[model samples]
Target: MVNRTNRTQPLSGRGAGTREAIMTAAERLYAEHGLSNVSNRQIGEAAGQGNNTAVSYHFGSRATLVRTIMAKHGTHVGVIRMRYVKAAGDSTELRDWVRCLLRPVTEHHAALGVPSWHARFAVQVMTDPLMRTLVEDESLTRDSLCLTLQGLGRCLYDIVPPEIRPARAEMARHLITHTCAERERTMAEGLAEPGASWERTADALEDALVGLLAAPITRH
Candidate 1:
């Protein structure tokens, strides 16, 4: 099993196009099937590379390959989120910071021009017991996320009880990530109900998160 304990830098760009093709193919395949089930040779064939060793050459191991794909989209998501975070100013509103946290994901998938794979790709990483923390730290941790978390936490401080904050934050992360993955899958399959859009999804999620975060905590 490929795990975070192995840290290998994929040889950069002997053939830039081939490397991207491999990453794209791997991301799509991994999103569809668990990464544990896919093989390097399968990813190589999907990338249109005839050599069975192509994935091993470009990316040292499956762990490195998964990191590469996460980094690919994460950079853009961070940049987009930073813009929203900066735009948010010092507002203490819960929904404002929630938007900062959530919109970048929806907008990123939307910008991918439909049938995007990254959301589902991300859900797999989030659910994986082995790779989850590694990818979360390496790819998903951004200055923008930190800033948004700081801002959001400030808004929640007066509302959420201290002991329950961490659990609530975890729940919020699950809701946003999984919900976006479901929406992306539905849209890709042409099964999204009428009137569904990324913006609307974000709005609904923001509403739910606002209430969840602001709700009173009861000690058992």
Candidate 2:
């Protein structure tokens, strides 16, 4: 008997490479074309795989494919972020905290070739319910990223209200997300203009975020 479902099983070696190709292409296309607009067939084509069934085999559905992509990138970025966050000593300032939050994504962008449309794509994915749930599940485990956030919270314990620390942390996360979206957009637009270095963008973003997150502390 032939196992028709064998193609759907997890790939390894060269097969793993092929699956990664599909995922990378899907991410690029979905980020470029938007999730709703990009189809399984389109993703397969972009991935250089002739079979549309690869998407089903690898991810089960279009929604799952997008989720997988988000999970891959989000987890990678989150791990790098948590390293910096967890390493900060007792003397970490608000700006150092901001750097820990901001550096991973910017550094990745600098290395991974920042997309011209990533800002808009980020805004969409962050706001989308399905994607948000996927992100929360894949990246924000209590022992992982959440613990890092709690550490930051501890650093600011003297300045922030104990009762509202969770709320403030949530707000800070949103502010970082939205600010990154805007920075990506500004970079996309400003790349053709003068003085568009990633360093400059990172600095400006860090300044803006420091203002947003630290303002409350100053008021207190």
Best by lDDT: 1
Candidate lDDT scores, in order, read 0.86, 0.67
lDDT of each residue in 1-220, candidate 2, tens digit only: 7443334444679778877887788766766667778887887888888887777777777666666666667667777786776676453577766677678777766655655444455666777788877767766663446655665676676766677666666776677677666666666666434766556767887887666655564345
Tens digits of per-residue lDDT for model 1 on 72-95? 788899999999999999999888
User: By TM-score, how accurate is candidate 1?
Assistant: 0.91
Error of 1 at 83 (Å): 0.8
